[model samples]
Target: MTSRTAQNGGHYGAIVVGGGQAGLSASFHLSRAGIDHLVVEKKTAMHKWRDERWDAFCLVTPNWQCQLPGHPYDGDDPNGFMVKHEILGYLDRFKAKVKPPILEHTAVTAVERHAAGFRVETSAGSFTADAVILATSLYGTPSTPRAAERLPDDILQLHTVDYRSAEALPPGAVMVVGSGQSGAQIAEDLHLAGRKVHLATGNAPRCARFYRGREVVDWLWDIGQYNITIADDGMGKKRHDTNHYLTGRDGGRDIDLRRFAQDGMALYGRVKGVSGGRMLFEADLTSNLDAADRVYNGINALIDRHIAEKGIEAPPPSVYVPLWEPAEEPAELDLAAAGITSVIWATGFRPDWSFVGLPIFDGTGYPVQRRGVTAVPGLYVLGLPWLWTWGSGRFLGVAADAEHVVEHLTAAVAAPRQLMAQAG
Candidate 1:
């Protein structure tokens, strides 16, 4: 490795920003295609899997889905969920095997159009490339509601990215906002850790971890659920928008809103705002729970239909009854009286494309691309949710999408050389 100062103004055929799964996968494809490329990472490879995730976090997808370029899980635990360390180890092994040309601790400061390609200015140095693939995972920046700013300064407020374990938080009831996968899991973690947890529920879909003796993921895969592309129709778009609130806890068990309520976790509606130290919430808790139940039932129906149509022998469907009695929705929460001393905003994340000085983003600041290909030549994005298929952002599908982008990029790189050869 060269000193940062010495590598200033270097050039490469291609540049990949981020050293996560997406970028590493892209580098593998680029290297195999004999393309001269450099991968610039602000932190170590798979930094989020190592640092940002919580202590108990596990892959919601099963081990078999942990597919990267030239690496697939061949272990016996295909149905088992991988813990945080296991995922990190897998990424490390993949990195060692592929050996992508990565410049660690090199943060990209700005990326601007340079002639037909791009000029990437980083903390380490500036580099020009014929193509640039922004593989910085879609969820780079933690997004909190605007109301969070109004909370008292004394309250220890942290986003999911900052949360590790319940011990890290101050002693008191913890209010976890957001009912998506992260929020639900964190709420469970806090509750299991003996903290009085209050969860702000949303309309995220819920699914059983296993259905008919097979993992839910396996069932979904068999039914071609992950292959649903954006162009399929409005139904595909709706499926892309819905967040699956399944848990990989307890070696992969079903997670439902009713379970949280039965476990004595106070469920509130979607958080509306905060004023005078009181957090206002919508009175939609029951509706949200009902909606999740509907989604679960719908998934079961689909599975049943698939089994019947294919004559697949599977275990009988298990009937699930609500474990908790419905309670009146609390319109507001008095933080002080409830003894809540901290808040974990598991409100999810958005892409941080501030470094990309381009007009490729949509109104929501997400890149507007067609399967990772941007309108701007030589500029691409990978590992984005719903980039092509439902699994585009997932570990199972990131490498395929990366390969798709690199093929086009390498072709573009080769075009000029071929033209010069023909001219000569």
Candidate 2:
């Protein structure tokens, strides 16, 4: 840990905002390049993994994917999934090894372009730097649908970030909105805990945890799926838009919506609106389910083709059949009659860049950058979805992306000095 007091109003070669994997990685590379930098964090390191996750939460990806810059996973169980504690431990060890200059509990309030390069205002104090790397993860704010406001006052609403466990929820049937990974897993958790779960299905893709005698993630990695950069112009847009629905339970398991339906989870299409204390759903539940099925099958087909082309021996295909019938879904669901006392919004999240006083954001509020390099010279962003590669935002890819960003930062820091020398 660096001296927080020393950083107050001090100038540096660069400043990395955020102390998670992305920030830590950036610090590592900057230090390695002999550049002076400080990593400012709002809370303790790996705050989200420590505080935001549920009790039973485990990484969907295998332990092998837990790759940091210098600290790679040399654990005994590479195929197993790491729980929350395990992840925190891994990060703690990485922080200890790297020993980057980090100021804990220091929150950045504002970032503005300054003559020195950038002026960063934080809870501690203000500092100027020649470069700034915004390493905050993509999902900074939990997003709930607008319809949530119209729900009855008696109905308790909690976003996925606020949800800790099923025991914390009120004793009644629960409606979990959004069928993404968190929603699906939470619905299963609530259902198993004796609560009737109503899941609003979305267009998230699903895949079996294991396929053809190998983990699906392993297969994807072997097929260079993670290495597919946005620059390739191949399935990058689609991959960036879609969220994969799988679970890290019972070693690893598939979480299809049909399975939840068969297990007594009331499945509905996207929640369209709310009126008269009644929730309205889209009538395209079957279509949404079919779309998910297509994605699942498509992944399997790709694996099959890879196996055939590579001459690798693999098990025969084990087809999955839909258990739920496609019937006319009710257009409206009465909240009172349904006995739903609580609503858990698993709708997902969006990045919060309100503190950044720069014109680098796009029309959609996402930062406009090319592979972490912002339009502004001294500004950079890391751990953002599709920032460079398909896995750019993930733990497995953050280190590599950080290295690339820091390389640019190195040259960015030198340009001014070179110009001054030339003029002299």
User: TM-scores across all candidates?
Assistant: 0.95, 0.95
Which regions of candidate 2 fall more than 4 Å away from where they truly are? 234-236, 421-424
Candidate 2 lDDT for residue 326: 56
**Model 1 misplaced stretches (Cα beyond 4 Å):** 1-6, 235-242, 318-321
Provide the lowest-lDDT 10-residue window in model 1: 1-10
Candidate lDDT scores, in order, read 0.86, 0.86
In model 1, what lDDT does residue 98 have?
A: 82
Residue 337, candidate 1: alpha-carbon lDDT: 91
lDDT of 2 by residue, 380-405 (tens): 99988778876678878888999999
Q: After superposition, how far is residue 95 of candidate 1 from its true place, in Å?
A: 0.8
How far does residue 362 in candidate 1 sit from its true spot (Å)?
2.4
The TM-score, computed over Cα atoms with residue i paired to residue i, of candidate 2 is 0.95
